[model samples]
Target: MEQEEALDWTIRTRDPDFRDWDAFTRWLEAAPGHAAAYDALMLADADLPALVPAEPLFAGTPANDRGAPASRWRWRWIGGGAIAAALVAALSIGMTNRADIYTVDTRPGEVRVIALDDGTRIEINGGSRLRLDHNDPRFAALDSGEASFTVTHDASDPFRVTVGDTVFEDAGTIFNIVRAGDATRIGVAEGEVIYNPDSDAISLPAGRALREDGRGLTIVSVAPESVASWRQGRLAYDNAPLADVTGDIARSLGIRIVGAPPLRFTGTILLDRDPQRFFARAAPLLGVTARHTRDGWILKERDGPQS
Candidate 1:
């Protein structure tokens, strides 16, 4: 039970948006060997060093980015059988090294550009997981996170990106994709993306965006330049869900934004790189009041002034 809980905490704390440090510290203090067990498990894995992408670009770093006192190795556990979800909490030993594949995992609030052998440039957002093949060069998979791709298209082979079951085939253009939780979003700015060309293919051209969630796929019109605007220190939205907006804020700012209003937002917000400065202007626009907490900021619906 202790090891299971330790493993669970290990995975949770590594999450880009993880908070609850006090609670985690309490758990660490609960038993003397608890921290030891956690440390031992993490040290054993020693997550491979992330290779620096050529021609990297820097972005703002989030403040108060605290977590467990451990190394920066991420682990992904995959157990065979029906109850694989449960195994995630019980074990943290599924990281694999393949000769053909490599992964680039970004830190929260970090933005950088990486190049492929084919000269395709990808600007990856913070807290993202992207896998690339050193051998194939054309096969890329975004396990989770967000990235903008400027593909070096090939008519014969084409560049492919796998997200969940869907594959985005580049059709000679620039586009951005994001997979947050179960929801996936893609937008085209200068080129086109074939949403699964094999069967039920959807042509996604410039000035358009698509979002897939539990309710299904929703296609909407977006300003072409606004696509992946985060690359330029801004976030643009059009009737976007409150949860998604806040989630994006948390990811971009690298702090745990703890609540979402039951509302959708339509506007653009500048990423000022400073939490307080950003909220001072953004809270009014979002119609929320940001209250500071030990864990992070809590966004509450504006309900008049306090007594």
Candidate 2:
């Protein structure tokens, strides 16, 4: 029974995405013999001499294959117990990813795309934080920032994204989500999404958008084609609050923008990595003069602001 359990753990940890570190640590620490047993199986897989097993449990047979070098295997066999303990300590130290959680983050200017095991793809914008489970593909949590999800629909197992206390579940959807400060914005480019399906349910269909903040929930209209447009370096807006527009440019372009949206905007702003180049074009469309300051860019009302 002990050998079988140890064999199971050895095989599981070998998986590239295996991240249930805490449980594995507990199992090893629960019994004194667990670490020795687990390491023995690991050694056998590498065709090295096992510390506890009388013979290599599953060593391969190859005529020309001399086993892994003796110096390396000898060190591992002698130090397996200590090494196992050290691994537990190391995996337990990090607070970012606890238990089965695996975090994916991007730098301010970085964009990343994560492909999950079950054919779901998530494209996270710059300055985004997303979390996924090592075992569950349908679950995701957004700690902060923006992400675009293109989920493969499974009626039996709907894909769910949790933002703060709110939950959004996909129903054959392609959606974009942004969480900034105390505000969350959701837009569905295709299909539908259920907001808290179990209670106070709200359905967001294609071309629909929702924003929630300390104020309350507000539903709005969005252009279906313009959703997740940041992926294509274009931001499309129709009667969008200037605050939302400015927030997006700052987030996607990776710059600090300080301003209050006293007015509404309706236009498209092309993305440019260079701040100077970007504002030169965006300011005209936004009807604001972009001034570079020591801290960041400040958007002041342009003389004769565009109507």
Best-performing candidate as measured by TM-score: 2
lDDT of 1 by residue, 1-307 (tens): 6775666566567565666666776787588556555654454344321211111122232344343433211222222122224443223443232244556666778776777779899989888988876578788899888999999989898999999998999989799999999999999998789998998689999999999888998999999989989988999999888888888888788778887889788899999889999999999888788988998899988887522
Q: lDDT of candidate 1 vs native?
A: 0.75
**Residue pairs with backbone atoms closer than 3 Å in model 2 (clashes):** none
TM-scores, all models, native as reference: 0.69, 0.70
In candidate 2, residue 168 scores what lDDT? 98
Candidate 2 lDDT over 68-146, as tens digits, reads: 3433334333445554444343333432233556666666767878778889999998788888876799999999989
CA lDDT, every model vs. true structure: 0.75, 0.78
Q: Which lDDT value does model 1 have at 101?
A: 57
TM-score of 2: 0.70
Question: lDDT of model 1 at residue 258?
Answer: 86
